[model samples]
Target: MNKTVSLDEIPYSPDSCERFEALRELPGAAFLDSSYPHSSSGRYDIMCAQPVACPEQPALAATETAWQQYFDELRRFHKDYYGTVQPASQDIPFCGGLLGALGYDGGNSLNQVSGAPPATRNSGGHLAAYNWAVVQDHLLQRAVMVAQPSMREADRNDVLSRLRSQRRVKHTEFQLGGKFESNFTESEYRSAFESVQSYIHAGDCYQVNLAQRFNAPFTGDPWTAYRQLRRTASAPFSAYLSFENNDVMMSLSPERFLSLHGNHVQTVPIKGTRPRYRDSGADRLAVEELKRSSKDRAENLMIVDLLRNDLGRSCIPGSIHVDALFEVQSFPTVHHLVSTISGELSPDRSAYELLRDSFPGGSITGAPKRRAMEIIAELEPDSREIYCGSVMYISADGRMDSNIAIRSLLCTDNDIRCWGGGGIVADSQWRQEYQETFDKVGKFLSVLEEMS
Candidate 1:
């Protein structure tokens, strides 16, 4: 059954920006901040939960009909004010409120992707939380959401140390979280190269994203940990995903999958990558390498084409264009060559239509999306619940924004798992591609090890 509790019942001042942080400190309430500044509605949102019996996917899916019904009601309410408020169901993979209803117990769910238990629990990391069902109250008028606080405390250092120990035991561990080439194995690295070559030979797809997993435990205040990561990595658009039994956190990101500002919609796609260096000279060299690498360029351009096509579906005719291409943006651990694809959205299109057109991002899926998805499904045994999905915030005024789900963490009752990877094309060298994944995860793993 669905329940609703006003922000007033919590300790925080609902009107304050810090309401999210205050609510996060509340008892049995896990907070998810969409930070929907692009919308005309309210700013911060929340997702709260009280103890409830666990329900698996089948039982959980049964709520889909009701969820759609509730969403339709919301749409009707906003139709007069705004052309259409993006439905809650329209929020992609990491939709905040929907993730809460999906539950926070993360034990078996962790193994579902990693094939091994995670070091921590809470796996609803990147969600497409859609709607809120208020049993007794009128629907919320803004982009606000409600989630209860977590039942457990997540300590950073403890979690970090636990991950380090696990890595050692698994023999898959790399020192420095394998940020540089010095830490990873040649065999593992070569495997990625071989896969790229095989894919190329078979003509299955132009590029494919390959990733690996890392685990850790926790010992510090999780909210503090999130703030620290944000300071260190500081993504342009960021999100904090946490649940009662699990937490998924991220800090470094350079892509915007989609956004709805008033009636306008947009998406930014990133397609190339290079590791960052401490020395300015080294950094320049890495960016230079990324720019000059034909393989990377080809891979990036292919995705650009894919993104353009994806946006074209819901976008106004002749409005689609590559705003920026092959622009390198530097992060703490890596340098990435990204592209911006923009379009004037078709007035009749819905958020779900936009997502369906661009479900798995081009960077992750390759040139031809459906074919690449098929290959990915075959190569990977695990189901990508929310990794490639987008995390979005939709206002009551029909405005929204979302980020590509990458460099993210997932947690459940028993484990914590984070995934990172890069796109591989025909000329791709497997070793380099594999190492890139490690580099992407470096800082995250470092923090996790510190806690462990």
Candidate 2:
């Protein structure tokens, strides 16, 4: 059963960002913000909290069996409660189901094909069973609180009452204690770039993405910082997730890893990039430059080909193709060359199966995904953790959506961390490639640093 409570009944303004205020302190909270400007259609913001159950995390999955078993449980749990339930409407992306970030390392544990370094942490990955979510539809200029049949009447009413109140609670102000320190200096990054080039020249992989981590001490809740970043650089696939163990993630990702609506699936991989400029002419030039760069096009094609192969595992034969290529999209901080590839999901396959077959998106890994993984593991010093992973959701009606965890930040143990990197190809210069990493995340770091 699906219960839809209109935004009017919540007593807050139709466009108030505080509509979901009740979920602020709730455990297992997750917000998928579409931030679709101009009040347009084609996107919806979904948020939920207080998961009924979640897998053991930070050490839960030690092997492939453990990984499959947990997901299997989620399938059964959702099926039992939401099998007959559906999204309130076609545009709603989620309607009470599994919602959480699938840390990048989650795939490292589940993937038997990666001959590269095995999952180093031995403890990562989590998915939560959510019974309710507030869906904000910008197109309709309306919102709905959809609750699952599995939830008790008392619980649902309690949630409704809280929403109607629209009570505001004071939160600790978030501040960076100091400037973020990088794990790699210029010389260190150059060394990694050279190694990746050697791998490309040796035919180990076509291109490998290497990254550097930056961290600084911080105090207060990450929610404040997330809001600040969103105000400046909010993306179509942005998300904020707060979990136990002081684990919090704020992702302002512009890359769509995968999305499924019934049998149709699509992926938009971002490849080339150039920073935005304040001058109108300079900005236009940057976009034009990204559009015509041959080296960037070549790099983009390698990942496109890699992803087409990945989708082949579960997509119907003869149904996969590149719908669009070399399209340039301008964001607040940069212009990116993105390409769309889509396929029809095989009738025999489910959404999670498709996800399993194509985890750790190929765009992040290089061509010949296995060898690229090994190269990446050998080059980057620390584990990627959630970066390059995904913020994903599987709905009761089988709708699915996820984002590549680039331009992401994490708060754990008073340490605030974020990563920046890009695909490195044979012709890529070490200096430009190194700077690209910062260009990807530099603005985000500035937002946090300003809070100090």
Candidate 3:
């Protein structure tokens, strides 16, 4: 059986970021910090440490069968509490991260998309590892200690006390040791852009998101870099994960891949983009221009339709509908056209099943999702790993929330890597699309430059 022990409330403070920084020192730590806490419906700031459970290997394939097997194993390991601690209408009871490359196995016919053989680097797995931990919910000022039924009360209290006592530390210094390199050169990217356009003209796919990876040798505190990233590009679904063996993930993602509350599921796909202007007037104009762009509207609508179809597979018939469309949301570095699609999940479906149907969000993959993945694989030089993967939380009672792993960074023993890209339609400009990728990642790149 599972256990939930409520402890003394941590003093609520606006500056939870400091507390989050302090919590990162713990093993297998993860934090989800909200950019707009007051407006958020669920727990805004959550910090979890010392995972009592985790998967032995990452879920690497995006195939439904693979995911089913992976989930089966995960459920097996946590059998004692598999169906306990039901969602309390407002509680999120688990913590985990979903790697982006899982899309490769999610029933897409991309087996022929060629690239260099998959890198042997252990960039964490493509699947999420759910762990029972001591979780701090800053919004409710509550600390929930989830442990095995056998864990003693005194131990739970000790863990809660340590979490309450954590405080922000002085930022550490990091150095970017060498010049960063892109996996694809400008000409090469342009060539890929043309290839995607040709596919569009051939009626193969309407839109395809093409991306390039950037990497540099580095040696520094990843936590410090994550702190800088938070300050530079505070996003609605920001996350930080520190694993054993020096592997780290820092995500400041603004897109919501999926969320499940009760049997209701929602996805917010982001399609359009415009760089934020420092000048107030210019910024207003940019937002207006994006709002009026027909091409962007079309781009967003196509994905909205795509997600509607994906959700329909698992949702009650006639229950799937668009909640919002072409809404412009501004982030620290860019403006985006975001749309919300929601549906009531079929009664028999579990959260994992919902994810299986919508493994990769449509906004990132483009219209006719399968064809886009094939093109992405054929053109991109390496496996995306976690770049476009998801960082998510799945509650024990089957609640879940996930973010498309955009505006993210990965750290290994010697190198730091990040990726940025946009969806390509026939009307998309190669140069502008190239610039958009940089614009999307500009602040993150700036942070790296400052550290270098």
Candidate 3: where is the Cα deviation over 4 Å?
Answer: 1-8, 36-43, 54-64, 75-80, 88-155, 166-170
lDDT (Cα) of model 1: 0.51
lDDT tens digits by residue: candidate 3, 186-293: 999999999999999999999999998899988868877877777778887877776557787788888889998888889999999999999999999999999999
Worst 10 residues of 3 by lDDT: 96-105
Q: What C-alpha lDDT does candidate 2 achieve relative to the native structure? A: 0.80
CA lDDT, every model vs. true structure:
0.51, 0.80, 0.72
TM-score for each model: 0.66, 0.93, 0.89
lDDT of 2 by residue, 1-452 (tens): 44442222344234334655577667787888765662222267887888886445434346777776666666666667566664567866787788887777776656643433334331256578888888877766677778776677887777787777746767679988899999899999999899999888997788888889999999998888887887788688888887678688888888999999989999999999999999999999999899889999999999999899989998999999999999998888888999999999999887877887788898887877877877877787777888899998988778999999998988888898899988999899999998899899999988788877
Q: List residue ranges in candidate 2 displaced over 4 A.
A: 1-16, 36-42, 54-61, 65-70, 113-123
For residue 80, model 3's alpha carbon misses the true position, in angstroms, by: 4.5
Distance from true position, residue 313, model 3, in Å? 1.6
Ranking by lDDT: 2, 3, 1
| Candidate no. 2 TM-score | 0.93
Candidate number achieving the greatest TM-score relative to the actual structure: 2
Off by over 4 Å in 1: 1-19, 26-189, 217-221, 244-251
Residues 1-452, candidate 1: write the lDDT tens digits: 22222211223233222444433433344343432332222243444333233222332222434433433443443343233233333322122233321212121121121232222223232233222211111123233332222122343223222322312111122122222222225575466457656876898777777665565444335555555455455554555555444444442345677876545667777777777778899889989988897777777889889888878878899988888888877766677878787888788876645654555566776656665555554454345444555555443334556667686655443344566777877777666777688778777766655534
How far in Å is the alpha carbon of 341 misplaced in model 2? 1.0
